[model samples]
Target: MHELAIAQSIVALAEQQAQNRHAAAIEEVELEIGVLAGVDVKALDFAMKSSVKGTLMENARIVRHDIAGEGRCGDCANVFPVNRLFENCPACGSYAVNILKGKELRMKSIVMATIGLQP
Candidate 1:
């Protein structure tokens, strides 16, 4: 599934970042996903659970932020909320609309594990 690939990429990114900073592990990771991004959250969650084995994000708390769809009507210049891309403008019922948001899938932040010297 594509979600597995996505999960793999996410884990790889976290590992790369942790390696760069020399962190022992990843504490947390925040992801921003838009409604219009065509991503299945359940599948991604399952994939991530299986993919993070022995990785830097194995114990990290993953947070997901769902972004609402927003679009502007080209005919009336009115902005409105949408759940899908095929939605027409609410103000003028125009099909010519430009999406202002809700097409994103990316990592927002990552919290690295602190390495302390304990004797």
Candidate 2:
């Protein structure tokens, strides 16, 4: 699946970050994935497990933050929940709407080994 590639890219990014900091390994990783990001969580989890094999993040604890879909109506400035890309405004009944959230797929934070340094 495409999740494998996503997982591999995640691992590579984390590994590269750790290496740049001269870390011995990665301790934890935090990710933010929105509900409307179109990612299969189960598949991504499995792919991540496989992708981290023998890598710096092999022992890293992964933390995910799930964001709900939110949008704002352009016509009436009404804020509402949106599950689809194109949604009509609940208040004004207009199709003009801007998504405020729920389309994110990003790595939030990465905790790395101190490697003989005090923090």
Candidate 3:
């Protein structure tokens, strides 16, 4: 699955950030995944767990936030919740719907333990 690739990318990003900050280890990683992002959450989670092995995030806590899909009707100017893409507007029954959210797959934040000089 492509989720494995995505998970690897996430790990690579976290590793890069940790290296940039001179971190000793990564403590936590927060991810924001939208419902319409076309990713399998369960698969991504599994892939993430596998990808982090022997890495800085091996012991890190992974947090995921599920974002709901929202769309705005172009014809009626009505906003409504959307479960899938290309959905017709609920209020006007028009097919001109513009997506307002729920297409995100991003790393929101990372917590790292920096290497400190011992006295």
Misplaced by over 4 Å in model 1 are 116-119
* Candidate 2 lDDT by residue in tens digits, 1-117: 888988999999999999999999999999998988888888999999999999999999999998889999988899999987787998989998888999999999999986787
| Winner by TM-score | 3
lDDT of 1 at 46: 99
How do all models score by TM-score?
0.94, 0.91, 0.96
Error of 1 at 61 (Å): 0.2
Clashing pairs in 3: none
Question: Which digits, one per residue and each the tens of the lDDT, describe model 1 over residues 1-119?
Answer: 89899999999999999999989999999999999988899999999999999998999999999999999999999999989979999888899999998999999999998687576
C-alpha RMSD between model 3 and the true structure: 1.0
- Backbone clashes for every candidate come to 0, 0, 0
Note the Cα lDDT for every prediction shown: 0.94, 0.93, 0.95
